[model samples]
Target: MSPRVLIVGLNYSPEHTGIAPYTAGMAQALRESGWDVEVITGLPHYPQWRIHDGYPRTGDPHEVIDGVPVLRVPHPVPHDAGQLRRLGMEIVFGLRAATAPWGRPDAVVVVTPALFASAIVRVRAALTRTPVIAWVHDIYTAGLSETGAAGGPVTHMMRAVEGTFLRSCSGAVVIHDRFADYLRGHMGVAAERITTVRNWTHISEAPTVDTDALRRRFGWGPEDVVVLHTGNMGAKQDLTNVAAAAQVAERTGAPLRFVLVGGGHQRPQLEQLATTTPRFEVLPSVDNDTYAGLLRAADVLLVNERPGLTEMCVPSKLTSYFTADRPVLAAVEAAGPSAAELAAADAGIRVRPGDPEALVEGAMQLHDEWITTGGATHRGGRRYVREVLSRGAAVRSFVSAVAKLLPVTTEHRAPATVNS
Candidate 1:
C-alpha cells in the first residue's frame, strides 16, 4: 500500500490568495505522487479573516477536493485581529484540529502560521510513532516581531513553545535561504534538520489577455504610468508607503498612478486612504486568470514590505511576479530575502522601506528604463523562475525530504479510508 500522508495547516484552497493556494497545490501534487494524502485544516477565513458565506462558522466537517479528504475544524474568525486575538484564534484551531479524528498515517506534514498548534502535533506524532514534518512557510516568531505583533510575556512563552516544537519534529522545511538561517540562528533548530524548498507560483501559465482593453477599463490612458501591487494587503506589506509615494508622485507631476489590487484585513484602511488620494486606487481580488493578466499589463509591479520585515519569510507572490516577466520594484530591506532574490535574478530594483521619495524616484527611473530598453533588463526573471522555482521541482524536493522519515515500502495500492 502507498504511504498515507496527512497535512495540517490553518489555510487551504478555494481561497485563491495567501498560503491557501500553496497548501492546496502541495496536497494535490502529493496525491498525484501516489501518496494517500489528506488534510486537517480550518474553514477558509484567510486575508478577510471571516469565514466564507456557505461554510458553517462552527462544526465544519469533512469534505473532499480533487480526491483528497479534508477534515475541517472549527476556529474563531477575527474581524479586526490584533496580536492577542490572532494568537487566541490560532490556539483554538490548533486544539480542535489536533484532537480531530484524522486517522492513522505513515507521516504527517504540519504547516506553520498554525504554529500555535505545533505542540499538539509534536506530542501526537511522538505517541503514535508517526513521523512529522514541519512545513514552515514563515518564521513565525520573527514574522510576529517584524510585523509589530511580538514583545510580551505571551510572545516569550509562545516562542519557547514553538522552539520546542521545531526541535521535536522529525524534520522541517522552509521556503527561502533566509528562512533556513532564521530557523537555525533564532530558533536554535539544528542546521541539518531544515530543508529549503522555495515556493512555486500556484497561478498557472495562461494566454495573455487584452492589456489595452483592461487598462482602459481601469481608467488608465497612454500617458499614465501604472504601478501595480497585487496580492494580500496585510500589515506586513507597509502599503502606507505606497500611498505616500503616490502623493509624492502627484506633487511632482509624475505620470504615475498606484493601484493596490487585493483584499485583506488592511484593505479597509487603504480604501479609506484612497478616498482622499487621487493617484491611489484600490481594487478587490480578481480570479487567477485576471490576476495573471493584470501582472502582464502593468508597467511596473511593486513588492513593498513593512520596514522591519528583513527575512521572516519570502513573499510567495514574487514567484508569480517573476513568471510574469515584469520589472519588479521592491521597497524592502537591502539585505533581505526579497531584495536578495531580485539581486540574484537581476529581476528588479530595490530600495529601503519607508522612503516615499526613494519609491517615487525608483518608479520613475524604472519607467524610463523600461521604455528605453523595451524591458530587456527584466527578461531574465521568467527564465530563472522556470528553471529553479517550478512546481514540479519544489514538490519533488518536499517528497524526497519527507520520504527519508517515513517507512520505505514498495507496494502501491489504494489509500485506506479514515474509518478503516
Candidate 2:
C-alpha cells in the first residue's frame, strides 16, 4: 500500500483564490506522485465569507475534489469577520478536525492561517506519533500587529502560542525566505527544519481573447488607464488607499480608473467609498477565465497594503500578475516581502503605502512607460515566472521536502517528477 498523507487546512479546491489553490494544488500533485492523500478542511467560504451554494450548512461532510478525499468540517461563516470572530472560527474547526475520523496517516501536513487549529492538530499528531509538517502561509501574530488588528498583550500571547505550534512541527514549508527567517529567529524553529518554496501561478493557460472586446465588456474606454487590483479586499489590503488614489486621479483628471475585484470584510467599506469616488469602481469576483482576461486587458496591476504591514503575508496576486505580462504597481512598505518580490522579478514599480498622490503618480508612470516602450518593459515579469516561479519546480520541491520529514521506510514511494 502507498504511504498516506493527510492535509489539514481551512481552505481547499474550488475556492480558486488565496490559500486554497496552493493547498489544492499540493494535494493534487502529491496524489499524482503516487502518495495516498486525504484532506481535512472547512466548508468553502473565503474571499466571499459565506458557504458556497450547493454546500449545505448541515449535510454530508465528505466529498472528493480533484480525486482527493476531503472531509469538510462545519465552522462559523461570519459575514463580517473581526479578529476575535476569525479566531473563534479557527478554534471550532481545529477542535472538530482534531476529533475527526481521519485515520492515522504516515505523515500530516498542517496549513497555517488556521494556526490555532494547526496547533490542535499538532497535539493530536503527538498523541498518534505522527510527524507533522507545517505549511506557513501567514504569520498570525505579525498580521495582528502589522495590520493594527491587535497588539500589546494580545500580540505577545499570539506570538508565544504560534511559536510553540511551529517549533513543535517536524518541519515547515514557507513561501518566502523572510517567512523562514521569522520561523527560525523569532519562532525558535530550527533552521534545518524550514524550507522555502515560493508559490507559483495556479492560473491555467489563459485563452486568447480580443483585448478591445474584453475592455469594452468591462466598460473600459480606450483612453482610460485601468489599474486593477484582484483578490481579497481585507484590512491588510488597505484598499481604501486604492480608492483614495482614484479620488486623486478624479480630482486631477488623470484618466486613471482604479478597479478592485474581489470580496472580503472591507468590500462594503470600499463600495461605500466608491459611491462618491468617480474614478473608482468595485466589481464582484470573476471566474478564472474572466480573471485571466481582465488581468491581460488591464494597463497595470496593483498590490496595496496598509502601511507598516511589513511581514505578515505576501499577496498571492503577484504570481498571476506576473503571468499576465503587465507591469505591477505596489503600494507597500519598501522593506516588506511584497516589495522584495517585485524587485526580484524586476516586474513593476512600488510606491509608499497609503500615499494616494504617489500611487496615482506611479500608475501614470507605468502607463507612460507602457506607451513609450510598447510593453517591452513588462517582459521581465513573464521571464521571472518562467525561470523562477515554475509550478512544476515548486510542487516537486514541496514533495521532496515533505518526503524528508516522513519516516525512513520502504512502504513510501519516491517522489515523482511533477508535470507542468
Best by the TM-score measure: 2
Off by over 4 Å in 1: 58-60, 152-156, 410-420
| TM-score of predicted structure 2 | 0.96
Reference-based TM-score of each model: 0.95, 0.96
- Worst lDDT run of 10 residues, candidate 1, spans 411-420
Alpha-carbon shift of residue 312 in model 2 (angstroms) = 0.9
lDDT of 2 by residue, 198-264 (tens): 8999764464666678899989998999999999989888898898898899889999999999899
> What lDDT score is found at residue 310 in candidate 2?
82
